[model samples]
Target: MEKDWPSGFPGINWLGRQEEEAVADVVRKGALFRYYGPQSPTHVDQLEEYARTFYDVDHALAVNSGTGALFTAMSALGVGPGTEVIVPALLWVATVTAVIQNNAIPVLCEVDRSFNMDPEDLEKKITPRTKLIAVVHMAGTPCDMDAIMRIANKHNIPVLEDCAQCNGGSFRKRKVGTFGKVGMYSLQINKNVTAGEGGLLVTNDEKLYTRLVAAHDLGVPWKKGLPDETGEVCFWGQGRRMGELAGAVANIQLRKLSHVIAHMKASKQRIKDMLGHMEGVSFRRLNDPDGDTGPFLILMFDKESHAGGVAQHLTNGGIDNVFHLSNYGLHIYHNIRSLVEKVPLSPAGNPWSLSQNSDSLFEYGKGTCPTSDDLFERSVIVTIPSRLTDEQELEMTQAIKNAIVANVTS
Candidate 1:
């Protein structure tokens, strides 16, 4: 470790001693699996209940990973072969994979500063095959749910809120995931609520919850040791149950989520405010539920001015910044031209809209997302969300501004 870290270096200590103690107890007793015993609350079960109460949903389901939760939710929503789900083009690979893994075609939509799916773009892409609109609350900034919901409802499509990065974010006084039929949050080590590797799915619909539970638990629809208020249990969802240690650790971290989120927001704002209004840089927009902003700060660079190359300059100067790209943007299809060619649609509609033919443009293709294509080449990620003092945030902001504005002439 460096003698001194950059103030908020360690993000959130999502796993505390309480979690270790619980896990230790479980390990000591060798109850690593669910269905360990009756009258017992395995780490996973309590975590599910905590998620329900925290998100204010009727029920919660715990799983092995965020991807797992997404897959389960997609299955529960009946999104499968020949179906389509609207997903944003500026999120983690897991978001797109969840749709494709469910055997549904992921209709990639563009994102605005909020980094959430653009409702207008989403509506433009909806079709008879569109069964669910999966909105990823990117970088903890909420999506425009009012518009998203309006379009979704009008199209008769159930919304699946992918809140993997917005662990504690909300929309209009309600949790981010609560607004949709199903919501999923990640608990990876880098997440605001780290548990090494874990995920949770929440919903107000009993039937949906039952299905997710079965999906995560390997399609075994019966409740293990938890006391079922009703004797009858469904016969579905299997192998999605979280590990005992992950569950135990999550419980410890759950109590501190609110506090941790508050600190993260304060830190996040500092980075945003510092870079906001800076020449040739754009900050993400805030439209969804305002909770603890997630762990990372997303910045868009000006592609016309060679933003990607500028970002490379910052990296060369010992300042680290990351570019955000969707799975389809990076893995499924590396270039926008190929993706559009394969999709058989106007390139104007895809998330790669910024891929203009301009010589200065970030080379994706013509008519890609004006901002995204530019940002992909020039964007910067400050730091993974970490708790820090004022001085540290100031240093980061000042450094970013200096590098981005370096030799930039009007």
Candidate 2:
């Protein structure tokens, strides 16, 4: 008789005595605020230093959220009303909203089967008014940074990478966050590294780093430059700093990230190998399989009907397999009404009229990106826990195969 699988996989836990001690230390010292540092090594400062070194970037600034990181990056890069920020058609809602938050128009570009920005389409979307190119490494898979960077370089446009879901992902052996002018990472509950709710923005350019830090910290530089008559220094900024307690937790989590990613990758690949040869089933091909963080086990079916059947079978087998599209609710760009309308509601379009390069050059509604639409319709995503024991992996793969066999007709 087969062993009964646990009710649910045990979620990843780098948090333990270390995290408890870190939080306790913060509470005891009442240094919950990042900037309340009279001590030599503050939590926030240490986190920033570690993050910068981890990604091998020159600077890293912790913020309140991933959205805050993106918005601050755009603002620092001078994205404002009437500017066009090239973004992949398929990405998290935060990616689009961050562009809008800067009062810039998001020029949604197409994505290919890789589920990343189509470099070809990205090139086509570029024009004189294009201010920046923001690329999301969707599902912990790195976008084709080589192609994207080539395209951006040809047009002399800067790039901002949305690495929220790609903490340990990479391209060509280089970490994902280092591919662009600036990169943002999320430390939310679901992310690879969690600080409850926080974000980190990293960059190699000194000037950009200074601007990003200033923008996120209410325009005040870490090292004071100038002060007004009353001895007050003023800079254009907002309160986007991460709390010291979160910072401390994040620091502990960061240390364990590599190990977490390694286990995830191993488990994901094992599952992929087990399920690859199943009839009518396909897997998302990684551009750099070695660089993948392996947080998800995504499968695709040759036909939409086949995918539907597999989804139903998985449900019947007591496994939760999500069909990326046709789900009651999705956050993809096509479903977002606010992104495809006119005036206050359609900020992207509204800015077109005011844009200096406007020839009324944007259209949004159903079928904006046919490729992205079809990509999701034929795919199923299964979440991969940070750690999966051999027995659990075997049970999971067996369940998947059982589901497919039960559903396949022919």
Candidate 3:
């Protein structure tokens, strides 16, 4: 009999005494608040310290959520009205929403076979109003950071890396987040590491770090556990601070990230090797195979009908979390209703109709990116669980092969 397969909750599979003890210690110490409490709080500070070292960055800030980190980073990088931020089509809704939330226009760039920001399309999207390049490392794979950075440098545009789905992933040995001006990671339950819910920001620029710190909290940089009134960086903070409770769990989870990623990567590679080459199916291109965190496997088919048929066959064969790329919801650029319809933040008709943003008009929806649309219609994405026994891996491999043979070879 085949063993039961695990879901895509990578870090949760490894959770045990460590997380429990960490959380219990915080509760017992009465340090629920990160800044101050009955007992001196240290978990959030320690988490930031460890994150700085883990990502090899000069500074790291713990925030309330991945979305919060995006807003904070964008604000710090000067993404505001009249500016445009270029982003890949195959990104989470939050990535584009962040650009719009900053009162900036979001320009969608086409993703290549790697399912990452196509450096070529990214260049064509840049204009005089372009302010930031928001590169999202989608589905546990890093973008081509070298090519992206080269373009950004040529145009003097700062790059903000959205590493929410690809935490612990790297490109060409350098970590994904470190290559950009700032990198953001999510600690949500579905991420590689879980803190229940939290986020982190990392950067090497001291001035930018100061701005991020201020923007994420009370609009003033904190010094020695207190908000510094005389600080150079000050803005209207959104009050997005990570409490000690989340920090406690996130601190422990971050330590186990590498181990979790290693297990998942090994399992994914083994399954892919077993499948080999199917007549009509091809694996999504990996920019750096060794650098992939490996929580998802994207299979491209020659036809949309073949992909849909394969997806249904996989579901019937008990393969969990299978999705036809077009129906993958908000992850596809055209499926984001608010973006496609150009929904404004308020009734003010701002961001889109504002005088500053008048020249940056662009359309959204299905036909916005023909190249990406073709790829999406003919692709299927399968979730790769973090922990898979030998038997389970074999079962998954056979299930995928059987699905393809039944749908494509038939």
Q: Rank the candidates by TM-score, best first.
A: 3, 2, 1
Q: Is candidate 2 or candidate 3 better by lDDT?
A: 3
lDDT of 1 by residue, 31-114 (tens): 887775532467777787777788888888778889888888887778765576777767676776666555456666777666
Lowest lDDT block of 10, candidate 3 = 1-10
Pick the winner on TM-score between candidates 2 and 3: 3
List candidate 1 stretches off by more than 4 Å: 1-3, 6-14, 37-39, 224-238, 274-276, 292-294, 304-306, 324-371, 407-410
lDDT accuracy of residue 211 in candidate 3: 89
How does residue 6 of candidate 1 score in lDDT?
42
Off by over 4 Å in 2: 1-12, 37-40, 224-235, 326-331, 342-360
**TM-score for each of the candidates:** 0.83, 0.90, 0.98
- The candidate scoring highest on TM-score is 3
Give the total clashing residue pairs for model 3: 0
Among the numbered candidates, top lDDT falls to 3
At residue 213, candidate 1 shows an lDDT of: 64
Order the numbered candidates by lDDT, best leading: 3, 2, 1
Error of 3 at 387 (Å): 0.6
Residue 98, model 1: Cα distance from true site in angstroms: 2.0
The 10-residue segment of model 1 with minimum total lDDT is: 354-363
